[model samples]
Target: MRKIFLFMAAIISAFAISAQTQTIVIQGPNGKLMADLSVPSLNTNEKKTVAILMHGFGSNRHRPLLRAIYDKLSECGIGAIRFDFDGCGDSDGEFVDMTVPKEIADAKAVYEYVRDLPWVSDIYLIGHSQGGVVASMLAGELDKDAVKGVALLAPAAVLREDAIRGNTQGAKYDPITPPEYVELPSGIKIGRDYIVTAQTLPIYDAALQYQGPVLMLHGTSDIIVPYTYSLRYNDIYQNGSLRLIKGVDHSFNGYEKEAADIVANFFINTVNDYVL
Candidate 1:
């Protein structure tokens, strides 16, 4: 009985020390958005840097990779905020009809939301898959001031190309399945309800033209977005760098720990001065 009591006490104490994680809500112009904000107590009293995590298409902040990234960032003494895109998770709006333009606006709303925080000294953006594309378009304007550099995680190198894959005349619904693709669980389908905007091409171009100190990380075997996306765009940034992990897939299979470490190192070492 004494051992059982001691074990329970230890579990309770463990939870108390890691209570830095919290779910927070921020209001957009139209409605409210929810996110999990967590930071290690390293600089709890002092101002610390912040990173906003943007998840991929059809994924909210609750995605496994996002949560893993958040935990990784928190352990590295960096404060991170991850939220659901509009119409997904706890955020307002409809995602079925959402487009890149509207999603970018939502990204901007979240960025603005982070900017208003008192303890945030630097605002960096970390995005995965399609989220990386959205972050890239805003890289220039978002980094103008207060915003920092951007991290592109398995970004869709050719977003419009991917978006139009079976979109004959922008009509019809074809699942984004593949022999070489990441093999996302069943029931995930391309959102055909959305109308592709001209913004997609421009965003792709801007992502390739972005000159900031961008860190592009992609799995070598990622067929979903393909690692070539990062390789082909390496020269776009004057200070851009790429790290292609070996034997990794689109979702970075079996390598979340390594991926998280690489991401943390980039934010710490590369993005400090890039933060405007």
Candidate 2:
């Protein structure tokens, strides 16, 4: 009777350990950024690889698309961390102060935090839209050995072009004399610094510096960001591939599962290849 009770207790403990999620707060360039860290309940003692999920512009870390990817990665025995940018979601900061450079700094902070974990064997980045831009840049900036792979979904590299044209997010402003702040249709306020900084950023040049496996997914019907942008990335990356999803929007709305599976499989394969 005692042996049977002990066996049942051990099995329950193993089941509980298979999957776990935790709410964590990490310091960002501006302030605190809230995040959810999800780990698979694998019984192995080996160090695990983790993917950091980055949301699109004006979106929070808990956006449905991000959450869906996070769960899918966890189900695949991969861990994931999704966090809000400093000005968005539950993080501390004003949205008006947000910029591409600032968000890059925020991403670096999160990367450093995750990199120091003893249980993390490798790190990968999965970013959507603007977040994808940040991930690409950061992967380049970090030591080549630090980031094993990068996955971009409908990356919005058009911001740089829009800034140069003096029209960004449907608001026209003099590039040389932008206002201290401009409000968008959604009532989100962005500073002129954001425009000036984006205009001068060598996004592609910097992103292509990271020599790692890259996976880019874009939808043919994504009006916001043309699928050609991803094709351009594929051309730039030495070891990159692009997949065009048919008739889907920028958000991959109805094809969340497909997107998540692609990301998870890419990371899984990258990790396996690295190990071998």
Candidate 3:
């Protein structure tokens, strides 16, 4: 009987989530970005806050970690939009042509779309790994008031350093004269443009522009991108806090729910008023 009740509860929860989700498409720099915007099922009188969720390198909006965060935010009566950067997921671009600048453009396009929405009262940014870098840079590009707060999960600022070192995901190449493309161990080929731009990305210079509240959550055991990268962000931001989760990996493998809760709580506390 208990098992049956749990199964029924899961089904109901899935139904509720699907009912609130909306498919949105925005024209990104390279192509159309496929996105899912999850808004709380609130009445007209209730206030709504939305967050733009960005995924990491070679990841999609539907990644387990990202989806968990999206669901948690929605459950808290917060609106969240998770989208595929051009060349990833269901988007309309090739992965080989993707770059940091292009991903930023994709994020900017989504931000503009959200800013124009009439129902959204406040906006926040939440990103993981490479997506965290894109979110930081995009928030810096826009007005501080535009983004109420930012939450970065295992932000991968080490990409720039890796580019300078001519090594990416254990794939080594000559930084001075990189080939047309370098393929990762996963068999994904990144173009030369990605390497060249990553080598000199004004990541911190642009990220620190937004002097708003920043919450950085990184794991002590993250081997892909060291936790030191997030520490650097915390040190540079005018108002930033870093929380290092011991024993957690870059993907927050065993702590997905905890990581999502942190991001949801950060946005919840930052917002002046919300439905739930």
Candidate 4:
């Protein structure tokens, strides 16, 4: 029987040693990325679609939103793999050394791993916050054929603007000549490499390359990365839709289930269409 998990931590704890889910590690650009793979039961000859779940800048795969999505996907007979970026969660590396490009590389590594899985017939990319930015660019790089669908939750294209303005999550610095690092109010220090690379990132340019279906969900009340970013994303993709949930914050604090259901359903429908 397949078990359904609720919270990120609880689900992870229950599946850590279960038969349906397994904890795996993938080597990323910076180091190891600890990941959890949850799949529904299937015949040996049957291949399944899987979604790669990416968390935000200061978050990990174990985030409640990501976990909720994982649960939904599993319940719908879709597989999901959520992992820590090189520097976050149980993965190896330092947070200060993390950057967008580095995270992209890490995502690429995960992509390579997932594509090679014998049981995975199709793949989708889903991300939140800066992770959404990574998913967009990565899909753009891989094109639509490689990634069947994409879902961006509060994509943070504003990172470039933040870099250009010499401010990141309230940490100020000189855009022209950034220091070794700047620490955010949350005490996570980002390196100069992060700011320099973010300033010139072709976020939308790369993301727009993927002509596949895309679903972007953002909250009007989000202050971290305005919902307008998602609107702009909706404007670029060859096929894309944006949903602005009123009153929901960036993290979807009280709307996790709603957001996750929308995302899971998008992927499920896309998979069904492709199979047909």
How many clashes show up per model?
A: 1, 1, 0, 0
**Model 4 residue 106 distance off true place after TM-score fit, in angstroms:** 0.4
Off by over 4 Å in 1: 1-19, 40-45, 165-193, 198-200, 208-210, 273-276
TM-score per candidate: 0.79, 0.91, 0.91, 0.91
Query: In model 1, where is the ten-residue run with the lowest total lDDT?
Result: 175-184
lDDT of 3 at 128: 96
Give the lowest summed-lDDT range of ten residues in model 3: 267-276
Model 1, clash count? 1
Candidate 3 wrongly placed segments (more than 4 Å): 1-19, 45-47, 271-276
Every candidate's lDDT? 0.71, 0.87, 0.89, 0.89
TM-score, predicted candidate 3 vs. hidden true structure: 0.91
lDDT per residue as tens, model 1, 1-276: 999999876764653465387787877654677888875454455777778898887788977778777877876667789988777788887665456766677888888877777777777788898888888877654545545677888987566765447332233334353221222244333344342452135765666445657889998888777788887667666778899887788777677777777888888787775633
- Name model 2 segments beyond 4 Å from true: 1-17, 42-45, 274-276
lDDT of 4 by residue, 203-270 (tens): 99999888788999999999999999999999997678788999999999989999988997777675
Question: What would the TM-score be for candidate 1 when compared with the true structure?
Answer: 0.79
In candidate 3 the C-alpha lDDT for residue 261 amounts to: 84
- Candidate 4 Cα misplacement greater than 4 A, ranges: 1-19, 274-276
Clashing pairs in 3: none
